[model samples]
Target: MSGTVSDYLLYRLNQWGVRRLYGYPGDGINGILGALGRNSEFQFIQARHEEMAAFMACAHAKFTGEPGVCLATSGPGAIHLLNGLYDAKLDHQPVVAIVGQQKSMGLGGHYQQEVDLPVLFKDVASEYTVMVSHPSAIRHAVDRALRIARAERTVTCIIIPNDVQESPYQRPPQVHGSIHSSVGYSEPRVVPKEQDLRRAAQVLNEGKKVAMLVGAGALNAADEIIEVADLLGAGVAKALLGKAVLPDELPFVTGSIGLLGTKPSWDMMMGCDTLLMVGTSFPYSEFLPPEGLARGVQIDLDGRMLAIRYPMEVPLTGDSQETLRALIPLLKRKEDRSWRDSIEKNVRQWWKVAEGQAMKEANPINPQRVVWELSPKLPDGVILAADSGSAANWFARDLKIRKGMMASLSGNLATMGCGVPYAIGAKFAYPERPVIALVGDGAMQMNGNAELVTVAKYWKEWKDPRFIILVLNNRDLNMVTWEQRVLAGDPKFPASQDLPDFPYARYAESIGLRGIRVDKPEQIARAWDEALSANRPVVLEAYVDPDVPPLPPHITLEQAKHFAEALFKGDEKAAGVVSQSIKAMVEQLKPHKS
Candidate 1:
């Protein structure tokens, strides 16, 4: 017995456990949508735009760790989905895009909506095929595409001619079930040498004040790292990406390390008698310190990464978890708790200083103040998709993500326009969690607006728990301006960088969503209440002073010098210019200082 390929495809998709699909309906692809509607378990959500459908699909894959589906019609409709699909491809996300093609009659000769979709998508997709006369091959094509998506962790494409979509048939395609999980570090495929482990053990035993620096790789060994840190009475500092994985609230834990890093984390790293580098390969060698005095012991899966920039005293190649597990017993316990307490006290002092001085001023609200205010109102276990610039830095430091909040940005791709789509994906994977897109005005205007339709689909899908868009609207590229003054040494810019200011809140309002503009400092509470109270998509556009800079909780004297040197090239004349900028910054900081 035979059935319509569309029906078989739908049945196969159900078998794969794909419940939600993002796309828009058009004349050429009506049959595919009709087939999808027959099943109550699955949904083909109509998006405002085709590109948004691809974006939503990408986001879904990121959250679910499965291949997300995007459906589209012929020609222009499918063409609009390219950029978002590229994002998924580059990010190594699994997505399957199904596009409608003109009927077989339209082939070879000129016909309306007649573009070759399979050919068009060939480069972007991991695999692609067009089904015209081959009805029997459709099931195999889809199944093959699913396997590729699952294995390669990339996008796949399937083009079905209109006639094939409406072809006569009897039985639906056979469905199959799969139980796939993250390809996380599997069995300790490799282990470290006993000598290397012993050397690290020897150094830690010898050190009086030791601190363990954790990176993303340390996530699996968090418990082990914590155990060893406790044994040595060592303070723990992590990189920004390592935030959630590490024990943040622990007494011995210091904040992150870098320019934005708080606590005396960097100092702790430099001052420690032995610096235990657990699953980290941080690049900034200047900030890393001399490997000789500190005796850096780096434990990593890719042992070559250990001390690639700087030489290491102990380079152990193995699974972070396994190596850490083995080394835990070897470490001798320290009686003194003074070192850990001192770091904790420093963190508290710094926190108080930042909180005090960083409030909105009399004339206007600071961008940092906007972030500070949003910190509390953020939904618990909410998802944050951050862009590269100052917005990410601000969120990285201030947004208290202690117990909840899922961060999509793992490494430093830090491109603009990730927030909306990232949130939508997080929402797709975790239907229960309230997904949030915390975006800055400059960043959002770049790529985020394209994904608004994805959020709209969520609103239509569920009347309650819409994607909340908290936009930090400072009306200028504040992050870039700071980079120019602080890093580039040039505060001057062309007119184009100064973007056109608009009523973003009003535009969101016009789009059938609640758009509340918070111009004054006091309006924040009311705006947040409306955002939290409402069950629909809301855009909180907080107008802030673009000139107000974002400073991390702590900065070392050397980092300050680096900024000065970068701007002025160590010229005495440039000293005046750099000093003036620093003075202005210090004035703003004074209000927050203890």
Candidate 2:
């Protein structure tokens, strides 16, 4: 009650259950930093870069469903937090960013580190963006920002001037109680109307072959999803964000959809008569069934997103779990299992082809094999974070997410370098669980590698830390290279996609962490074993074969022709790329005896 405004803000944050703050120290934020140091309730987590601090905060919110807090100094530091804050915004995670501004008196004259942060962050933190001018207004601004962020699941910005932060708290008797008394949101159960549920069930019952596409919103409704799938005799395909919504081993559930998906998921979407979309706004409309090919029924909590991706005949607005529960009783059970069985068979066959691809011994090492080997080695309830490029493809196609396991990537933003920071945040949230980061060589060097020192700094503080970063060292932007050949019909340009090969393992070791490099297929398991057993943080760099392409589940004639064009253009790796594509085609076309 007698402390400075900064202390009051920290106390309010503590009341809201925010125990840790991720940020970097700077002159503009010295007052708040001092307050953070004085308070034993909140732990200050320092990062090498302000960007990583925001990334760590976003990841913490993503893993825990709680509003994560981050801070930064004025100017460049505040600007650096934009990318990570956008990641949280697009993903609809709750995060509050506190930025330091130039002293209150230095407003219009253009001080050294002055930047209009409120105007700059307008789009990212559209929910709430306020500059705390008076000390008495701190509680109101903090409470509103925290409430909106939690209730609406958005990014909120609170800017405090350097001088104002150190000012005395002017708490009036009118607003005396702590934030705990007034900081809560509505928790009403959203369920669809009975008539709407009945109508949705009617549409689903009429279709003989129904396919379900689910996303992150359907994660908590896994059991209901399985029940609905069973009742409708449907084959389920998951968007990348919803990869862990259902267990990978589910017989009737195909894996991820779109380019980073299994063959069965593609086939299910193309062959289904009705598409039952649940909680997914998958951006790629082309990957979905043709406009008239299938009737659609969509279920989502946000009605605005309903029928936005594909045309829906029945759009039900409600929570995924409650909506599914209400509709299940009215749904008619389908007796025929032919459609579901065929999709399951394809899923199983795809796994075989995938295994062959993952296990194939190549010149350097198959990138797929790194993820394949790492899959079985992961401890139970492990939290996995994958970068946005080729690493995501491997994680999507090869990594099998069990029920207890958790995994995420930059789903909507698809940004690189989030893997390392995400793993660090996950480790902080769940120290008992093993945390792994699957990053491409380019992404690791881009932003992930720098965060290793942050991990080293905090490694000793954790009770039982098991942080592992698996770098897919292919010495090229492999995903972009494949995109160039397949999507753009261009030959592999020498200086365009190629990246310099760095000693990631040695770098990790130099930072006082364990490091292991694997150039051969046989050494992968050993390297993983060493990394996992190490007491401190570990980096296992695998020299993956850059020639291996991340081929989609289904390849069209246009794509084939594109590859042919690339080969005709005298691309060095064209022949190998063609060979891999042909092999995949043959396996997909192989006859199923059943």
Candidate 3:
């Protein structure tokens, strides 16, 4: 009276609340994929590559606050899953990675698809465990793995042996213990006294170049923080993860600050004599110049992050939203609009010079232009998951993100295949809102974006189209050679670009999805329209110049100097170019000339 192991797995997965499994199928894992197809609640997302599938699942977990799941066959297939799984671990996403093992007996004997997955994934997984040979023990191990992934907010790699996967008579899945979000509730750490808010307000009232800096923890207080900034005529800049905290058009916002920060943001941070660090644990203490440069005050839910980096003159411990409300009334009337106008001017003209060029440029299409086209078309508050390299730069410079449109562009960890998978996570979290997975063809191919099929299969059963992927298909390692030639100072820097002309568009189309490819400038709109109209997964292959760089709004005097010293060292033209960028930054800091 027993059924196939595949059917049992499907039933168990449904019980585990895994509506989607992003993966590619092979001999070891084909049984699971076929079983996935048979079920109504569970579906397989056949990824273009193992990494993308893992990345997609990671994205699903980030938003959903659940354990995102991905599957891969043994050996090389499982090896490709590492990059994205590691990315998930760093980004604080919970993903359950299932790798098909060779067999229980030949595990260490070195078969065709043999790899000690448990050992390989030990460091990456917050928890690692192997599957049970007995059908009765299967559900508990899986349930336990899911718990570890969610509770620890890290990846959990589980090795399912080929025999176990192909076996029959396994028990059905069930909810064992409690499953909940990792959102911690520390003891009311922020009980900001009335006097603290009063003092913080006093500082804001008196300062000339007053500014606000927001981080991930403070993201929830966006509106109230905006209100406080408006009252004091302050400028705003964000930590890396806080880029989308406010609307791109906000008057007081300068941009981000760090190694990847905009020049104007650095200038404004230096310009301001006083700063407010609201709800953030920005750890770049060295970047925040010495204590004399500015007097900083911070408000945070986690008091530990308040002064962890830079020392604070006035530290107000309270809930970000509550603290802002309590302090709003104590602010004195400040009449100067110059600082606000300065940032506005900087944001406006810089885009005009940089992104404007990209938008209007003709043939040998610009990547920036593709992103620019996307910005206006996306719904307000759309969460965009951007990858690293030229692709990240293009979207950062050209995409006009609105307030509350959360985006996470990880630092040099720069995992290329993160975009499409991240979109899956964000979509899982906010199913009602639009989530776009943006990436370049080079990076996509590197990470293996074939995971779209995995998502498509999942969507078919769930009847949800939470993922929309827009790929800039330049068909080469565009960013790699560009960084070497442009940033790395290798004039004779030979490009590492080598890619095949595959039918990426046709591939997506075959799977009951929408695919559009635009090689020419004029075709962008029509292709975009076709992709946008579909209420399912959309694959947009925008062919742009393989070597263009995405420049920020303003390059500072300090930054330009560094660039000259590093790249142009003895060259006058490089120095002149650096000089011009500084001049532009200075002009940016000026009052509105327009």
Using lDDT as the yardstick, the better of models 2 and 3 is 2
Residues 290-371 of candidate 1 have per-residue lDDT tens digits of 6676766778776557778557678888878899888887888888888777766655655555454456363355556666
Tell me the deviation in Å of residue 269 in model 1: 4.4
Question: What lDDT score is found at residue 321 in candidate 2?
Answer: 94
- Which RMSD values do the candidates have, in order? 6.1, 2.2, 6.1
Candidates in order have lDDT scores of 0.69, 0.87, 0.68
Candidate 1, position 566, lDDT: 52
Pairing residues by index, what is the TM-score of model 3? 0.73
Q: State TM-scores per candidate.
A: 0.75, 0.96, 0.73
Query: Which predicted model would earn the best lDDT?
Result: 2
Steric clash pairs (candidate 2): none
Which of candidates 1 and 2 reaches a greater TM-score? 2
**Segments in model 1 whose C-alpha atoms lie over 4 Å from true places:** 24-34, 48-51, 71-225, 232-240, 246-248, 251-253, 256-260, 263-265, 268-339, 360-363, 377-379, 447-457, 463-467, 552-594
Compared with the true structure, what per-residue lDDT tens digits does model 2 show for residues 542-574?
A: 998887778898788999888778879888787
Q: Model 3 over residues 402-487: C-alpha lDDT tens digits?
A: 86677875543567767766776566556667767777776566553556655665554433464577777766665664444344
